[model samples]
Target: MKRRKFIKKSLIGGAAITMPFVLPSGRLFASSGNRMADHVVFVAFAGGVRQQESVLQRYLDDSQAYPSAGNIMYNILDGAPPTDKIVYGTTNYVNGDTPIPKMLSQTLQQQGTFFKEVNASVVGHYAGVNTLLTGNYMFTQGLRNKPLTPTIFEYLRRLTGEKATKTWFIGNGIGNSIPLLDYSTHSDYGAQYGANFLAPIVTFGNSGDKHLKNAKVYHPEEELDPMYKMKYFLDNVWYSQGSALPNIGNTEEEKLEIKQFVRDMFQKKDNGSIAFPPISDSGDLQTIGYACEVLKRFKPTLTVIYLSNVDGCHGNFSSYLRSLHRADHGVGHLWDFIQNQVPEMSGNTTMIVAPEHGRNDDPNGIKDANAFYGYDHSDSNSQRIFNMMVGPGIDSNLSIGNENNKVGDIVNIAPTIAEILGFKNDIVNTGLLASNQSFFDLI
Candidate 1:
């Protein structure tokens, strides 16, 4: 066998042996329903966004007591860019003073329904994201523990019979228990129904380059026989101890495809062909680039991207502002890529963006180099957030709720996604969510 082909086969065979496990028996019946769209992309605009800085577009007016006020997130919100005291773009222009050019002709708020104000009950990162994915304010959820309830991935896969590859949880990094969110520990829906998880930066960065960029082709008889026997022996020993390995239940074909996709991504990176935003400086931007690649290659029925670079507000408010600005740019790029590059998902995908939680109304007294005060999340203002959706069957330029009248909750996102994908009834019937109402119901 050719060396490349042998390496591929060897990796597949080795994975099969080392990760041997049983697939969960999903629900006996599948839902028979019509989908509003063929795909759903959920962006967890997380890391404690503040309502004053974000939806209010207060810029420096509310946060720093500076009279200057304008929108810094022009791609998602329909507002003019901030005019003065700019520090949220590439330094190549003028000391990071010039904002990145908007990628979308029309803002997402103009193209979709925008919930100006939404409620998030949880303030911490882990609980906040857990609530977003599971649609429950799991106050008991620990920072180190997997979700206590079935995540949306499990709900979609088990109730609708979607394959593992058709769903994904692409996290920015493998920190703060992000990889665990792909699945939950729920009895009815667990590993078998989990989405494939990838922290692409870690997977494709220096660590991957060092460990996975090359593989020696091991001869089947001379090298593989002993490895297979050792794997089986270890599996038996582990199983005998009443423990079993967790698997996402990717079929051999799906595994091979994923492996090949990883290889292709590395090659693309080398050739400067990865579909990154024009300015890919931050970790969030790089993650978004990989996310675009995933969308083009898999065209998944459901894909969740988590970005948290804006969490820098804890100490460096200027950097936080820059991260928030770049996040908006990345989102604009992602939507533009789907519409113009990924034909399979173009006009057939519903994209939803919501922060897991909001930051405090008051600052923590820590100032940045720009003499800006840092903020944390722990007050009522932290409950404030916004949710936006754009796609077929959704109303255009419709603005709902406001600063005084909140129309939706963070928990509504999972069912909203389920509704878009035609599985809302199944998900709601489980009686697991805090709010059974989808965002459509609010309309």
Candidate 2:
């Protein structure tokens, strides 16, 4: 009854604020197999990527005025740039806005295992990403709704007995069902095993900047003003109407730690102590910076970073090219930070990246400033996406699939991540996984 009251009173404007952090009893599906890596970073790469442009390294050949192609995504793969009609928004264009050079020498393809073609069964963004996290094709899952099955976060936390601090989903933004993917609605593994979700830009920008910045602790009865202010703030801003969003299952101690981290981040942002790639305005890059901060502070076992700037392909092709290149730049910086700054996670962590789905076969007739046609996603082009993994135990300079064949499914990524983090058997035995196969087994 006390728990019910706590939830009931916290419900303001139809949204339930996060209850005080606590852990439920017992592990659900404890793992018996040996863990492969100490940590896992799953880059959702949300917003479908196209094959001809991304893995195949074709820049503008498919949907632009130029018939030439080049490797704009230099960090993810090893390929050459387009020699003629180079109008994919490069500073190399001589009249471009920002002169950003492509980092080509030591690409992820050179250092990691790259899958040229991974099948993303679902074409829609919400369903595709849900498929990536749940290892099942969720045809029933819809926009702005929580997943219908257990996410990888729930699997890792429940099976490994890891605390909320050790599992995180750092999203780029809160749109569609992005925020809901942190946890699922499954009866067996639900809110109690969900990951710590921090939409840094969203939280820090609006309410946090005003309420949390340099704020002191307050007693409930002694300082009711601040409490009510916070209540109103959370209810009005953080959550939507009539939505009882699940909270990240952290212990009280972990909650305090996260609070401290947030305070420190605010201070760092003000003092310019936050380390980011110099002079970049992309939201994904900013999110990556905060994700790095979380890794440095908490050293989580699994961290999923979602990047969706590439979704600009829906309208502006030139901006899409720019965003895609900048996304690679952000990813490269993140890997570098892990290697140099976060010493504990430096050598032991495994990083796996794949898009939620791929773009359509042809343009949607939306042209950019450069006369380049923008593309969309559907069942037609969603069949082929790419996957890349780099870390200890993963094969280096290995490329799976080719022009003649497709290799993996987007659903396979979750099981593969589970296998990497020592919970493959547990996840597979749950009967939740579809027809996806782990990379470990494939290799």
User: Model 2: residues >4 Å from true position, as ranges?
Assistant: 1-25, 28-30, 83-99, 102-105, 218-247
lDDT tens digits by residue: candidate 1, 1-443: 69999999999999877863433435655565689999999999989899887889999999999987888899999877788888777786556787899999999999999999999999988899889999999988878899999999999988887898999999999997888899999987889899999999999899998887675455556776788789889888888887777888898579768888988888898999999999999999999999999999999999999999999999999999999999999999999999999999999999999999999999999999889999999999999999999999999999999998999999999999999999888888899999899999998
Pick by lDDT: which candidate is best? 1
The true-versus-predicted C-alpha distance at residue 416 of model 1, in Å, is: 0.3
Query: For residues 217-285, what per-residue lDDT tens digits would candidate 2 score against the true structure?
Result: 555456756777788788877566667655666865787688788889998998877767553577877
* Candidate 2 lDDT: 0.80
